[model samples]
Target: MLYLICSVCLFSQSTGGIGIRATESRGAVISPVTAAEPKPELSSDRAILSPRDEYSSGGNAKADRGTVGHILHFSDVHLNISTSRNDSESAAIPTVYGKDAPITLLVSALAYAKKVLPKPDMFLFTGDSVVRGNMTEEYLAEVVEKNVKTMAKYYATSDSNKMKDVTTVVGNADTNPGYRMNLTDPTTEENPQIALIAGTWQDSLSKADLDLFKRRGYLAYALDDTLTVLTLNTLPYSPSHEPNTSDVLDPFGQFAWLNASLAALQSAGQSCFIVGHIPPVISSFGGSPMWNETYIRTYKKIVGQYSGIIKAQLFGHVHSIEFRLPLSCSLGAQFQRAGVLGDDAIEDKADLVPLFMTGAISPIFSSNPAFMVWDYDVTTHDLLDFTVHGGNISSTSGTVDWQPLFKASQEYGVSTLKASEIVNFVKRAETDAKLLEEYYFNSKAQSRLQSDCQDATCQAEWLCSLYWFSTVRDYDACVAFTTASKSNTTTSTTSTIQ
Candidate 1:
């Protein structure tokens, strides 16, 4: 198990500081200037605060500014095309919010991303490349190929000489077309072998990653000396994606592999970012139970063990900009509840794992289609901020226009993205009429930024719907937290509402 302890700590009403020190780097920083108004020519590009200004602690007066790398993160681009089986003009998922775009609209969104956003050092896709969950093997192959080719086209170099390498993981839809519960079963009946699809993933992933995926459906890659990327194949863990038979081979042993990979990075003094399609949510915002109890327990254990080293956990498939907040209990408490680790083994370590839910590029069920740009300091692996680019998809109009939404720093009023900050933002928003109103209006895609919330009760439910708190007790705790916060505005009790 992973453990870290800081003998000294400072606890605040709104936030708590675990005595983790920030590492300093002497990199020369050139402050980036921002225009007073967004560039009209490229509305999709928003001026954001540079890391030097955003993360400056009241330290040295004249130290050089820091430089950091950026990541282009997007997922669930459910590309729909006419097929022999289905002649659907657009791919729309069944949901109160899901309303997706066809191929042309998707192309326009990608074009805008290419022209407006900063050239990223790395590109990440959390999966779901195809629109239809069920399709023939031939159709599935074609869809994956097209999805990879299209992304390659947009992120390619200006000279068109080199294509930026992409890091990706398998979504439920990517394994076999349509919804087949027999993914774990090969001997029972006729089933599309996942190996066939896994073979096709090589074009999108690195050579080493391709090998790892072929061997065990998961892989890890180091972005630089500072960041290690871990990709988990969560398809098997999802019952909706892979149901029954229990024959799916765990050749590489996902749990053991993850532990080993994370241990290696920790030993090397490197932080990490984990990418996956299905997040470990016991119950979804839609009130549907997703993961099996066993899987949830194991997943939480891994997260608990390495919570300190992981910089961020990025996932998609929920099709919204959601976040998983930190839990209040120490690892020991969590394990004691599970009856895994005893009270004697309890280490009162603070876990700060933040799971960022990236919205879908496909607007299928949702009114807005979106993508994210994660901005963080490379030296410290601190996630400073991120920007969401979303577009309005109209059935009548043939074209789609994309623009930037608010920045995390500007909206949340916090330079660092932490669980406490997010919790406080929700707590305050529940009581403050303006903040509550804005929360609902902005939760929608940039294209659908209108107030749908009728009252505070509705707004509170809408906000709570974004996270999977695991147990009924946890959910009730959040409701109580929000309710209590309304009465005592000055109380600074630490929240465990995940």
Candidate 2:
């Protein structure tokens, strides 16, 4: 069984030294920047810090100059087109919990985003546009095209009437026979699955990117002169991938390409956001590694090498909102040995790369359908803040009512959505029950499916998951520590009662 563990030493919070850290890298200093304008307050029952308070807080440094860009991020639509086509007139078809999203819900979600969210400079879709099931390749292509066109229509700029190019990563369910992708070389023998998606996304991808996608199943899009978004095809790395490609060391040569791309970006003095469908971490739900061990190791090495230039690593296969705090294996072991605690433990923030996974728009797993809008510093590409908008499917009014669930910076009391600040939030939450509960609620997108995480086992799992464990052994060590800590706490309480 998979388990998450939090050591007793990891529970203390230090009031001092708890803000974003500027790091010196390659003879240059990289500092966190905040949005020039404050985030608009959205109505919510939970208390939120005012925009004025957030800017004045010592944690976030407001940018004096630089554009603030908004990005709309959506993932795992899982549109069940067949169900919608068959039950066209029935409102009940859209509200069912255990099934993939019907067409009505998908359209409503996109339309709602367009109406409510700020106009985005860029849009992102992290794969799984089609539902998981056996179907002809023709039908599969049709569903994917429908999803693509629908997104294009909603996100099209008013002046140009053309949709902004969407940065996308291929999800496991996007291909036929979910989790299966032909291992043949794309240059020699075309993978029909790859070809289908490339053709469907022609309008959403540049000609160069389309050709690259046809050949390599991945591409990088330049957001500006200084920033790029690298969308990875993570299907081949997943442990559950079909056709048993375990013998293939570097499937589709993606690792080599990735390493080379990041190297070039680093040399060019440009930063990037790495986006993919599946994240390389121990799954909180399954309590197992999501990617093959070999792949995870190589990926982590590449990320560590370019940690300075990589702004964020975004993924969405879990269909839940969560983050992984990056730490080198050696550093994690060192911390574990010394029982490192407090926000001051991490001295160099560059060693930490922020890994965030957004919640899904599909209610298939009983998680409320959700999407997010991110405010980022255009010049530095630092994530300033983000608001998660979720729709409650169990609304008594018989319709999903979408609203702002929470804004990360305001809700978590962080200045910027940088690694250091998030690490501080985690440390503080360890000792604050109220803060931890708020995180638990947001993790599930405020869905009815979420249960109270009052037990030691559940709390430990959630806390430990925030720290990256490169291998199962590393994860097990943390688990053991947490288990022992819980045992000791229980014994102390029992002795007090006696």
Candidate 3:
């Protein structure tokens, strides 16, 4: 009812009757402009800076009883520095994805976030602060220090008395795990490197979280009395079982910890916001997801059980601006349907939550470097709206100025930050000529300048790859369908965080 009222007053131009989905928080319904549809795909899954009590104007004044809160979210900065050693492995592979982002690009992006978003309550960096390469501890140290230093300049105050309003989780690349490295022609070493990250990031984490993060590569801290930020290490090497041994990549261990953590938060009457690098959904682009099915199902069940307290999920491994809906079935139900909780499992539809994947600062894969800023309700911490800031780059010209591409509430004509509205927008863009063109060019770095999209077919294939948030399977399906429908029609078309 509140959303409908706000939608009419704010988005007066919208047509037809509105459909609303009520959040667990009473009187808070995310208004969906479109009707609810059965979502067949599986769902997927921050920091305390400034204590919760200090949320009101940095504790300068009592936060208006129900004032709105704002925060900035960015990810996949893949900051790659070059080594002078020409013969070294890191030197040989000059880029990951396409080209590693130069430090200047990252600087510009952060400057832009600071300028536009102003003083956000907190800054959330999903993961992958460093690019993968020949990573000796010394080299890794340099990488971590540079990133942390730069981030501190923006997120932290000069005095350093207060903990910075920053939260970072570990990415697969950050740890330089064995499976991620190339052995035959090794670029980075095949070893666990959590210590390098933890030690380097020590000052950024909360005092209580420092030891836990150093030991487990995951940590949780309260942002305020009402909200707790849970940061998880979704990397392959984040040992799955307790005692966290070297042998298994047990998502069970991660889930067990998460379950306990959520219970604690719920008991405290605090809501949760989870941050991680990998998403739980099956990918067709890369091989399989980082986590096993058992882990995913159990994770989803826990999220569902505490859905009342969980606010949002943030991720960035894919380096695209995308979202995954919440889980539909219980872990047991999904396990029963799929037989084994592996890739074969089917994800149920319903009880959808929002999983947002922020775009990368790296110009890899021709994606436009971009970032997002969100407006949220301080009382409920509900994401009210978001805007994508993107920049163009040229191999010859470097990066252009950053600008806002679109705002969700204004452009999409919806009030609430619901998964359905975003999904429907992406689905509609498939046929909406103007929107499809915009989506394709902005999906990757320097896409606007690239000549790869030779024709309509190329455009279609690429759009399909990006369609529905671009999991590996989604990409394969897009290519297949584009190829099959190649002769159908004719059309062609075509930022920076780093």
Candidate 4:
């Protein structure tokens, strides 16, 4: 295996094994590090991005053979430019409100990502930059333009809160429907995609992205080859059961061009990394599903056509850390299980493809608030390794002894709830759920419950039951559990996306 030297900065310690997981990626397989086990709980989702080819009706014509090494990404900012923000820490539900903190939080996290990681070669902010997509063209234009403009001056910056260079995408929130870059949220929305291509944001010299590159906090190498990133304005709403003509550019368009691009890039000894807002498809969770069966098939066909050249995928939409496991994934599989399609495929290529989510930047709960790093070896034009740094936004405002979200990421081994460390945690969540249930004692509730508490009549017993349930869904369960019996519907009225 060839090792490429990529660094966010001119300086970086080797990630090669004997100490961290880098060793495994390099060669040596070390035993999993054991720690005070956390309560075993249900799992969460991960996301990824891709672009359409010449076949789509929308513009994103199939890209040429292009690969940019080492890209760092963050998404679903819901920056709360105003006071409103994305909602509570519940993936099962939507939340919207005035957090009054996400703004500062996102800013600080961006600073931290720059301060700690090898200054990235390129920084990508995936999407949902604002709290809501529905706004006046003026509000949309002002918000997107102003914020994007300021981003260069401050994001991932720190000359005591300075700014840095960043490349951005037009997330669904960044535009009106049909690829429209709201001149201010236009009343007459034209084909948005074409509008953006023609907008001032695209001017190459120092428009917005340029001034950012001049910042000193972090740096990136401009690949000789044009690296293409595709941002899809997926849909207006999460309509159940398949998308419509309004969704894609053209049937012969997006996917078709995608295949051709992969072929072209590979033929040129180049690689392609897809970056978008929604994951293209995901697990059963639906709503802008990340990667579904159709996606998997299409992806494999395209990558296979290109001779397996995609190196790493950095994304953020979902707040937690999740990697889309390879198809037919069974529980209790190794990290590479999802990376490799099968044993034969593993034999074909020893490397595991990158599918990383940059966690959240906003101070919203659930996410520990963080950014990511991409150490690309300029000489080899290949990414050497990647790591995630957890952080918080509050430090900017005041001084509190706070640590990043988790001491450790990558929850290993399928948790059985029978594990000693998890038993109490599960019970605790269930107990909270019980208390939540009784709060209403009479309204609508979360229906995902697997079992009901038999001793619910006893307040003590009910408390324990609710506690057990709380561990899995966070407050969504609380809000849902209470809904059945309570008149108060305000528990979780905020939409996480606004």
Candidate 5:
């Protein structure tokens, strides 16, 4: 039954878009405007601001006085070293649709990021260093080392040539067999896979962090006196993960450690960003859960307990731009697992942490390669805004042109990337045709690879995904309600016209 439902959902996503017309031609670049240039009016609902207007606002004047910090985030490079070596001649350009990224593409992306934000406060790479495939353990280690060194080299400080502070999580593909990790007692013995990856990251991590990561494939890096980044090894929680031990309740003792760490952070009055490879939510691409229900429930409970100190949850693996709000299921609604609920079941917004899924640098999913530069309040550790820069891979010319795709603040018209603001945007998109269409276009980083969605079921899936529905029954209810509402709206409009 689950397999059948997943098959149908996958089909819907593959054919889904918001039926928004493409304004720019394939590979067309929009020039950045200067401060002197007159700002364009928001005449059309589909219209978005130029890169200059989007970012040049400089946020709050007080923040401009140097209280703002920037973090450069990259994810899922998925470098295919085999293809890169075999096709050295064409390695200067980005890889085409079906293949993972080549060495050239990775270098190009890092170089572009360096050029744009040379001195970001911190660097974040949330997983998958190598492409997914069968390979010898030695060869996999070599690939991982190369990917790590490449990033370190690019972000090295100009003054001392030291590698910048980089926080990374272990993706499923980082191991020999994807989504498989050995469950060993960290104190008594070390996991060979985690040890190998830790060796490559030695330069970027502290001695304590390296030791901890070597043992269990997770670490907490203190970014500042008030801010820390907790990078998790989420493989054991994944549904696709291969079971290696009988202790399913707490794989590698990650949850207990997580709860303790968060509690410590809370006691110290410091905030943190929870970074992980696979998120603990329903996969928006397919109507399936990313982690097992047990892990998800445990994770949610821990996060909710420490919600006051968790700034945001950042994840990769989705390979697309999207976010998940706190699950707002009421007490009775949570237990009632079989059917859709009435409108009152939708609870009011709460101050739960918001999860931001970063897009991939690999175009393997037919998504344009992209990365993000995040702005935040230095004192409060609040996420202010983020700008996504995308590289358009041209099929005919076989080259990638990098440009700023959109800034979250300007595109969504939100003051900050808060959960409440994002929730409001989701509500607005439900009825605003132009806003919904614009969001659908940006969701894929403006790639034309997937066709526009014309089906109502597909459209509902896209919108409800933002809410992070934990159960299929809840997700289905949201979809059914949305589809019917749209139908009624259309009918009412038509009758008025007559």
Candidate 6:
């Protein structure tokens, strides 16, 4: 278990460190461009501090900038179980494939998280918690209840064995078209989660069935004027054109209920943490024009419609952290977005410049499965800070340590942390893709060379040795090495609401 300590020392209330650290926010720092503008009151604008406050993790010289709410979020847990009929045969099990194993890694991640921070106010588990979103057929009461109990029981923490008054949301992989059956249909059956609001079954549960889940009882264990947690369920496969699918799937009736709930809290000056499966839009995964944009537009329509009350949207489907604060009309968390960066199948591809988007819990990901612990500041009532502990998630932590994950990544597939290596590999392939194979020939006879040359993998490596020898610069070889990498081959497909 890779334990993490997200230790926070609130030495001085005023000088919370986030501001100074955010010097990079505006890109390079400059002298008091002008006297800093007076801090705006909550009435004038939304809290400047983000949830899981990044701006609060101050390095700022100035103290007591203002009050803020903090949040610690986890998303995209594609947790898998040995439910596949294919798994009935031991030969089909993954241990023999020489590929990365999932069971041990996930256990390690869980153990790591539990070993760390004592507790967090609320734990948010976004969709895809159940791999394939098809744990057991709804008709099989024993199977359905067992699956729900196992899941809730599997990742639970706290004396209550609850992850948090955890606000859970549904993800695409959680349910699909064929998998869905009408909530009221005679064939439909339901198994209650210990207590959490998620689409009864991703797509399988229509909006009404989901609404029924909400109405059956409080989705949140504790709900009152003091706190309001909204668990919204938006399916992953809704078509691009319909923004109001909620009316059919689950009526925005829940949304209206949320609006009223938020109003009551707002009127009382109480704060709220609204969690959901999907974050609005940075762009859909592939930058599909319609995919993310529709969601963004729909999110705006609903949030804007309730702008008077709702505070922020918390979510975890992307499996990556995103601290997005819409400059126009902020919709989500004050902290933008955040996720623990390293986990199986997915590496926290981070640009340290703005790190929130890099962290998220990874279960059934890259090779490590982990979760986070958030310390909520009771004094300020803000999610102050969080620490991510890798679950029995060592690329080898269970049997080995981090090294095995890296080694396995190379043998089975590249680890996410090896982005630079991936870039290089792709670029090398791009030359071939571009039909520039003439650049190198593997013919042993034509390329015969001295032993040292033979020791080099390719002409490119030998060229490097020549440069080190200063015998010849081989400028073209050197220049190609640098220039080929300069051009970015990857495209941004994510949608931006702008």
Best of the candidates, lDDT: 2
Candidate 2 deviant stretches above 4 angstroms: 1-41, 44-66, 83-92, 156-163, 328-350, 395-397, 490-498
TM-score of each: 0.73, 0.81, 0.67, 0.49, 0.81, 0.47
Candidate 4, residues 248-299, lDDT tens digits: the string is: 3222233444454444455566655566554433421221234333343344
- Provide the RMSD of all predictions against the true structure, rounded to 1 decimal: 9.0, 8.5, 12.5, 17.7, 11.6, 18.4
Q: Using lDDT, rank the candidates from best to worst.
A: 2, 5, 1, 3, 4, 6
Model 5: how far residue 253 lies from native, Å: 1.2
Give the better candidate number (1 or 3) by lDDT: 1
Which ranges in model 3 have alpha carbons more than 4 Å from their true place?
1-66, 84-97, 157-164, 177-192, 237-252, 284-290, 326-350, 394-397, 423-440, 449-498
Best-matching candidate per TM-score:
2
Write model 6 residue lDDT over 1-498, tens digit each, in one string.
001111111111121121112111111111111122232221101112233333322123212323333333445544444554333441233321123233343444344333332233444555544444334543222322223333344443345632343533545444432223222211133423311324333333335544445332223323233555666544422343233342342232333344445444555665555666544444212322212333433344344333323434455554433333221111011112222111320111111110122223333333233344343433344433333333232233234231111111121121221222222323343333221122122111011221222211243332221111101122233324423332333322321111
Candidate 4, residue 73: lDDT: 62
lDDT of 1 by residue, 12-113 (tens): 211111221212211111111111222132233234323233332222121232565567787888777667525354333221234444566667767777
lDDT of 2 at 277: 94
Worst 10 residues of 2 by lDDT: 22-31
Tens digits of per-residue lDDT for model 5, 1-498? 110111001111111111222122211111111111222332212222221222333332332423667778899988777633454643664478767888888888888777777667778899998887888877677778878788888774335632235545889889988887878777666788788777787766657667777888877766767787787889988878876443477777777667767666776788888899998888766678888766775676567566678887889888888888754333124223434443433222224578888889888888888888787777778787777888678878766787777777678767677765665666666666667667777777878785575456667677777765555656666666667656666522321000
Span of ten consecutive residues with least summed lDDT in model 3? 1-10
Clashes of each: 17, 0, 18, 82, 1, 59
- Using TM-score as the measure, name the better of candidate 2 and candidate 3: 2
